[model samples]
Target: MDPMYQELKEIEHRPYPLQPSPWLMTQVWRDLLFMHYPVSTDIIKSYIPTELELDIFENKAWISMIPLRITNMRARGIPPVPYMNSYLELNVRTYVVYQGIPGIYFFSLDANHPLVVTGARTVTGLPYKHANMSFEKHEETFHYASQRIHTAKKLNVAYQPGHILFEPQEGSIDHWLLERYCMYSFRGGQILRGDIHHDKWKVNRAEAVISTNTLVPFIPGEFIGKPPLLHYSRRRRFFIYPLKEV
Candidate 1:
């Protein structure tokens, strides 16, 4: 079987069955860093769209800043282009459940590639902005940075994955944060959802030094000042289906 098909065999961990439609594209997220913070539900309520409700974990709302390199990216029936296929991305997102299905809600997504940024914005309806970013690996530790264009928001983080890796329990916070299979966005005065499928995430304890992170300005600096809950996954291959009205 093809490796992409192999990723679908472990669907028992999925919250719902895969979409009957064929996936539209594939990408691999490498050196991914997930920095999560708990925030007041009241603070997040206003940012959320009226049609959607916040997906709370442990009675508190959560948000995450993820910095990753997207590789092996190409649409169905096309081959991956050498330079265009890979780029760095930093996204600020929170969780939401719409019509009983859990999904991600993005506040912003910054990428280093202009074409990819524009294409994602037009194609997926998700927020994708251009930024200057870089990634450097030193043995087990990695240094990643990004500065968004036309805005003062930026991120600088150094993280390393731990030796032991394991699957997050079904109801654990880790599962709640990483197991989401779809994302919701508002475009053209309507709600849009895109189905996402990937193999089980085998994560390890992660430690990060967030020297500076102003990705979500409305989020108080106090939350940024406090240490965040960290998790790391070296890589994960993702298949994203097309977006459509919910």
Candidate 2:
């Protein structure tokens, strides 16, 4: 049997929290920037299996971004400040699970809060039954917001699509950078000097890809996790909104 094939098979059989050597970080980055892949990196930052304590993954890479959604427009109410209609801000948070270069991106859609309003349903042809709000990562969801926000005044928007770069000082990135990347920004950057134990390493690739395109980019109504769990619930859901055309 070939050595590479044997190793791949071994990794496939292993558990999620694969304790890769610290050196795995160096190798993975090199492979990414150089576009040389099919390399296994269990020694660096192995796949996170179960919910880990925050301390264990401190300074590790994470991402966070404001999700794309629209809020419902409220009807005008008779008020002291007359002739004014209220609008709820439809916004959400998204997380990006950084893979070597092209990371697997997952969207967290909240089912209870839907941007688009379908007519209330009736089970037995009577009045509305239980209300159902579901969020989805579907192509339709992408267009949903534009339609809802078309009448909304553009407040503040900042998102850049396409090849961008980040040069972390001693592998130390700014907290805002990681947050924009849709990951948790703790201590600024993930691969710090302590995390790397090296002088400099280049990241040739950094992407958030979906495992399958069957679903929408992100639906905001889904099960996040049980409450009272700090680290568990903080993670934002991710969805691939259509990339803006260059």
What TM-score goes with each of the models? 0.95, 0.19
**lDDT computed for candidate 1:** 0.88
lDDT digits (tens) for residues 140-234 of candidate 1: 88999899998888999888888899999888999999999999999888999999999988999888777888888565566675446788898
Candidate 2: regions farther than 4 A off: 1-104, 115-246
User: Whose lDDT is greatest here?
Assistant: 1
Q: How accurate is candidate 2 locally (lDDT)?
A: 0.21
TM-score of 1: 0.95
Q: Mind sharing the TM-score for model 2?
A: 0.19
